[model samples]
Target chain A: MTDETIRDVLTRRGLSRRAFLQVCASVTAALALSPAEAADMTKRLETAERPTVIYLSYQECTGCLESLTRSFSPGIASLIFNDISLAYNDTLQAAAGQAAETAKDTAMKNAWGKYVLVVDGSVPLAQNGAYCAVAGRSAVSDLKRAAGGAAAVVAVGTCAAFGGLPYAAPNPTGAVPVSEIVRDRPVINISGCPPIAEVITGVILYYTTFGVPALDHLHRPMNFYGNTIHDRCYRRPFYDRGMFAKTFDDEGARQGWCLFELGCKGPITHNACPTTKWNGGTSYPIESGHPCLGCSEPGFWDKGGFYKALSTPTGHWSRTGVVSGAVAAGVAAGLSTAAVARARQGRAQKKAASADSEPKNPTS
Target chain B: MPLSRGVIPIRPVTAGAPAGGALADAILAEIASALHEYLDTRQNHVIDLTGMPLSREDRQRIDAYLGQGEVSMDIHALVHSHIEETAYAGVWRVRHYDMGGGVHSERIEIIDVPEIVRASSADMAHSARRIEALRAEEGA
Candidate 1:
C-alpha cells in the first residue's frame, strides 16, 4: 500500500478539515480523553502517517473479526481507509491463496518493524503447533514472523489474549495467548469474548496516535478497562440497597435491580461493557438481564457456572462443580473486598442522610 | 414520534436540585466544575455523556439545569452535527446524528465556540485561494 497520510486521504476524498475535527472530537471520547485534547488529537490524526496493519487469525471462531466490523465510531470502513491501511486480513481481504500471501509478505517487508500486528485467536503450542495452520505453516510460526517486524502487537478478543473456550479443559492443542509467543514485543490485549466494537476502535486510534496505551496486569489497555463494570453500573444503587434479582422473572429483575444474586460477575469482571456498551450503545449482557459469563478474563469458561453467586460456593461451579483452584481464590478475595467497600459506603450514606434529615433547634 | 433529545421533556429545577440524584448529580457537578475550570484557564473541556450511564432522566436533568443559550449550529459532514450553547455562556451541548437520525454521541463542551463549528485556517486558506482564482478568471 502507498504511504498515504490521513491528510492525503481526506483531501482526495473532498472532505474538509472541520469535518475530520468532528470525528476527532468523537474519537477523543473513545480514547477516554477529555474534550480539551480534541484539538491535539485532531492534529495528530490529521498529520500522522497512516499505519499498516496485518491481521493474523488463529484457533478462533472469528467472532472478534465480526465484532470489529460492527464498530460505530470510525466504523470499520473509516478505520480501514482513513486511519489505517489494513494490508492483510484473511477474512476481510479479497486477494486469496498465493496473491494474498504475497500481499502480506510484501506489506510486512515494506513496513518492517513499523506496522501494527493485530492477532485474533489463541496460538496452539501442542503437537508442534499442529492444531491450527494455513498454507502448510502453523499459526504460531506465522505469528512469530509477523511479530518480529511489528512495532506493537494487538491481541484482539479473549481467545488471543487468554486461552478462550478452545483453551477450556482437557486441552488437546495446548492453546496459549499471543503474549506467550511474542515475548520481545508489546502485546496489547483487547480481551473480551469479542471486545466491544468501539473499544477495539478506541485502542487502535490511541495506539496509532500515542503508541501502546497504559495497560492493566493482563496487558489490556487501561483507558478502556480501568474501572470494573460494577463501579460504573447504573444499577449500583440497587446493589448498595441490597436489592437483588433472585430469578430471571422476579419483580427485582423487572425493576433492574442488582443481579449479584443471579450470578452477575460485574464486581470482579473488568470491562467497558457498562460504559461503551454493545450493539452501538444499546446494552450489554448484564443490562439485558443475563449474568456476566466473565468472557473477558482468562479461564472464564472453567471458572464455575455463569449463574452462581460470587463465593456463595453452594450453587453451581461449572458443570463439573469444580472451579480452577486459583480462579476460585482470586474471585473470593475480590468479592470480599467489594462486599466490605459496599457495606462501608452504604453505612456512610445512611449516616449522612440521617444527619441531613434531623430537625435542629434554633441556631446560635 | 421518535424519542430524541428534542422530544424529551426537561422540567426546570426550582427546588435547589433534587435529593439522591446519584449519576445525574455527579454529572452536573462535573459540568459546574468544568465551567469554573474554563474560566480560570481559558481552556475548553468536554464531558462525553455517551461514555457514562446517562439514563433518560439524567439527560433531561442536565438539560433543565443548563437551560439554553443563543448560539446553535448545524454542521453536516459524514453525519449531521448539532451544537447548541447551554444556558451557561461557554458551555455547549454537542450531539452527532447518523444518517438514520439516531443520536450517536451526546457531549457537553465548555468553549467560546466549539471547534467543530469553527472553520479551520486551512479550509479558509483553500477557499481564499479558490476565490482569488475565480477573480483572476473574471479579470482575464
Candidate 2:
C-alpha cells in the first residue's frame, strides 16, 4: 500500500504517519493475522472510509471511558477520533446543553442506518427508567433513539455488555445492558470491567474491515475472548505441579506459583489478557501478581468472591478405599522407591540375562 | 528386587527470588537442596529399595508414601468414582485426616483449567522460561 494515502489522512488529522502505521500493526497483531495479512490490512485501512461511531454513556462511572483513553501506543481514542469519525460522544463532545443534544440528533439523521453505535455503562430500567436521565430524557429512551437506525451496536465494557457494578447486588437503579433495551440490531459485547485497550480497538477494526467479526454464543469476539486466562497464564506450570499460592505475599506468590488457591478466577475467565495484555501489551493482571477477576465473562459480578479458587476435584487418590492421607503419602514414597530399585535391577538383570542367552561362538 | 524405574526428577524452584546469594550459585544451591529433600523424604517403609540409583530410590520412596492408605493415594480414581456416583452434579466429598486423631471431609468441585496449562510439563517449562526472560528484559 502507498504510504501517501495513509500519510495524507494522518496529515489532515495532524497525527504522525508513524502513529497511523503503528495502529495498523497493532490491529494486525490483535487480530492474530499473519504478516502478509497485516500488509493487506494496511492497504485496506488506507483506502477504507472511516466508519461513523456514536458513543453513549448510561448509568455508571466513566471508568470505562477512562480505561479506553488509557490505551497506549497509537491510543484507541486517537484512532477512533482521528482515523474514524466519532459523530457523538456525550463525554467528549465539544458542544454542550441543547447544542450537544442537537449534534447527536443531526449525526443520527445524517448517518441513518449506516453508523456504528457504541454504548458504555448500563442503562437503568428501574422505576420506568427514572434512575438515570440525560437532558430531560431517560437513558433507555436515548438508547432506543440512537440504536433505532444503527447498522450495529457495540456494547463496550462490562457495564454495557453485562450490567457491571450498576447491576451488582442491590441494583437500585435496576440497570440493564444495551442488548436488553435494543433488540433490532446485532449487538457485539466487549465484556470486561474495563476491557483491554487492544481488544476494544481490535473489535472496532474487525467490524470496520470485514464487517462484524465472528462472535461466541455470549456475543463476544471469538478472536480475543475465546480462551481462558488460566490457559495462557505464566504460572500454569505451578498449577500442573500442584504448587499454589496460599496467600498474596507468601512463598508461593514470591515463587510465582499458581494463584488458584488464592481466589484467582483465571481458570474460568476467558479473555486475551495473557496474550494481548495491558499497557500496550506490556503485562496483564496475572503477571503483575494480581489474580484474574474474570471481568469479560457474563454474570461475573453475581459470581462468588473474585478470590475464590475454581473448584477442582481433589483427584481419585482422595476417593475410593485405596488409601488415606498419611497412608497414601507413605505408599507413594514406597512405590516410587520400589519402582526405582526394580528398574535398576531389571537393567542389570537384562544385561546378565542377555549374556547368558547369547549363542556360543563356533570357535568356543 | 524387581526391575527399577528411573526417577522422575524433581525440578528445582526456578521462579523464586535469589536464594540468598549469586544467581548461579543460588540456583546450584537450590538444586542441591531439592535433591537432598528428594532423598530424605522419599524413602518408604514398604518398598525394597536395593540396586537402584539414588534418584530412583528417592522417587520410589515418595511413590510408596503416596500409595499408602493414609493419604488416599488413588485420588484420581476416587475423584472418578465420586463423579460417577454424583452423576457429575452436586458436591462430592473426600475425607482427610490429620496426624492427630482428628478427621475431616471436604467437598470438591469441577474447574476448567485454561487450555494453555494443558500442554506437557516440558512445554509449560519452556513457556515459563520465556516469560521469565521477558520479565528479565523488562527489569533490565
Candidate 3:
C-alpha cells in the first residue's frame, strides 16, 4: 500500500490543503458536529493514515455506487478519493476474475483487522446462499469472512441495511441484511434507495476521523438519520397549515403545497435527504414536485401502496381505532390518577379526625 | 385523411420565476457567508433589510426559506417591533415599527444571542435601584 499523506495526495491531485480543509469543515458541519470537533476532524484528515476500505457488492443494482461517482462537486470527489485507500471496488477497480480476487486478497491481508468493510447489497440466504455470489462464494460467507477481519462494517444502501426490495413480500431469494448476517462487528447502516452522495462521504469521513458517530436506535448515524424528513423539509409549513395537494395537476400542487394527501412519506422516512439534498444540493424528491417514497425506512416496499396517504390506515389498524385507543388510554390514565388522589385524601382525613378525637392532651 | 404531418405543436412555456428555484438559490448563497461565520466563530451577524433593495416578493421568498420557528415576539418600545426566530437556530427576523405602526426597518439578524431581547445596562441599573427600594420598604 502507498504511504502518501493526505496532504501529499491532495497535492498530487492538484487540490490545495486549504480547500480540502474547508471541505472537511463542511462535512463536519453536515454531520452536526461542533466547530471544535470540525477543527479536530480537519487535523485527523490531514495527518491520519488513510485507512483501507473494501467495498463489497451483492444483490444490488449498483445505483448506490453510481450516486457517489456522479457527485457534482469535484472537491468532494477528490476529498473521498484522496482521504481513503479504497482497495477493492469491483465496479471501479481495473482487475478482473482471478486477478481481481488476488488483489482483494492482498489488500485484505495487508489491512486485516483494521480495514473498513462497506457492503452495498443484501445477502441472499435461500438455495444455500447461491442467489448472489462473488468469486464463487456466497454473499453471506463473503460478508462473514470479511467482517471478522474488519474494524467495522458500513452497510451503504437500503438493500444492505434492510432487506429492501429483495426482501419484500414473496421474497424469492430469502434475502437478509448485512447487519443480520454480520452479528460480531459493529454495523453502521446508511439506508437510502441510492443515498445522497454527500451523506455517503460524510459517514465515511465521520467514521474514519471520529470513530463510530452517535447512532440512533436503528444503528444509523444520528446526525444524518435522527430527524424525520418532514421535520427538516422546506414544505413542512404547508403540511402544518393543512394545505395539501389532492392531485398531481391541481392548483395546490402548482402552488407547491404539502404532498401529504398525495402520499408523501416524509413523516416516516428518517434521512438527511431533505436538508442535505441530492445531486450536490440541487433538490430532493419533494422539492421536484414528487412525494417522498420513504426509501430509508425498513420494510418500505411492504408498507402498502406508495401513492397511498400515510394517514390512510392499512391492515387491521383503522384511523378511528388508533384515535379511539389514544383517547381511551388518556381517560384511563386520568381516572386512575384521580382515584389514587381521592384514596390518599381519604386516608389523610381519617388520620386527622382520629388524632383530634383521641389525643387532645390540653396544657399538659 | 392520409397526410404527411410536418407541423407539431410544443407545449407553451409558462411565464413565471422559471422551473428551478433561482431566487431561493441566490438568497441562500447570499446568506452562506453569514452561516459560515456563525459556524466558525459562534458570532452574531445582523443584516438590515431596510438598507437593501428587496421587494415584497423577495422578502416573502426569504421568509419561506427561513420558515417559522418557536419564537415570535412583539415589542412595544419607542418603536413597536416584531421579531421572529427562524427554523434554524441563531437566525432571526426583526422589524422596527414606525410612528404609523408600519414597518420602519426590517433586518435578518444572525447571532448567538439576540441583543434586542436582552435588558440594556441602563434598564438593569434602574431595576437594581427598584429592588433596593423594595427591600428597604419590606425591612430587609
Question: Of the candidates shown, which would achieve the greatest DockQ relative to the real structure?
Answer: 1
Candidate 2 whole-model C-alpha lDDT, 0 to 1:
0.60
Model 1 misplacement above 4 A: A1-3, A36-39, A72-77, A80-83, A314-364, B1-20, B26-33, B36-41, B131-140
Which tens-of-lDDT digit does each residue in A1-364 have in candidate 3?
4565555565565544433543553465456554345556777677665667889899999999998877765344535653455888989987899999998889888878887899999999999999998889988888888888888899999999887779877789999889899888779999999887777777877767667665655677766776667766667667757878899998778878888788777766778877667765557899899999889877776656788876566453312342234223323442332344335434544543454343211111
Candidate 2 or 1, higher lDDT: 1
TM-scores of the candidates are 0.84, 0.60, 0.65
Model 3's i-RMS, to one decimal, reads 18.3
Sort order, TM-score high to low: 1, 3, 2
| lDDT for each residue of candidate 1 in A25-142, tens digit (9 for 90 to 100) | 6577666675545566677777667777888899999998888775554443354433456777888887899988898899899888788888999999999999999888998899
lDDT of 1 at A203: 73
Which pairs of residues clash in candidate 3, taking residues 3 or more apart in a chain or in different chains?
A: none
B9-67 per-residue lDDT for model 2 (tens digits): 44455633222223233323433454454357741111111111113234443333323
Provide the global lDDT of candidate 1 against the true structure.
0.74
Q: Write the per-residue lDDT of candidate 2 for residues A1-364, one digit (tens) a residue.
A: 1123333555466444334544554466566653344565677676665667788898768877777776564443455544465778888877999999889898888777777889999999988998889998999998998898788899999899978888876788888889899898789999888887667767776676556655655677766765567655656757767888899978788777888787776755657787766765557888888888778766565555767554533232322132133223223442332344335434544553455353221111
Which candidate number would show the highest TM-score if scored against the true structure?
1
User: Comparing to the true complex, what docking class would candidate 2 get?
Assistant: incorrect
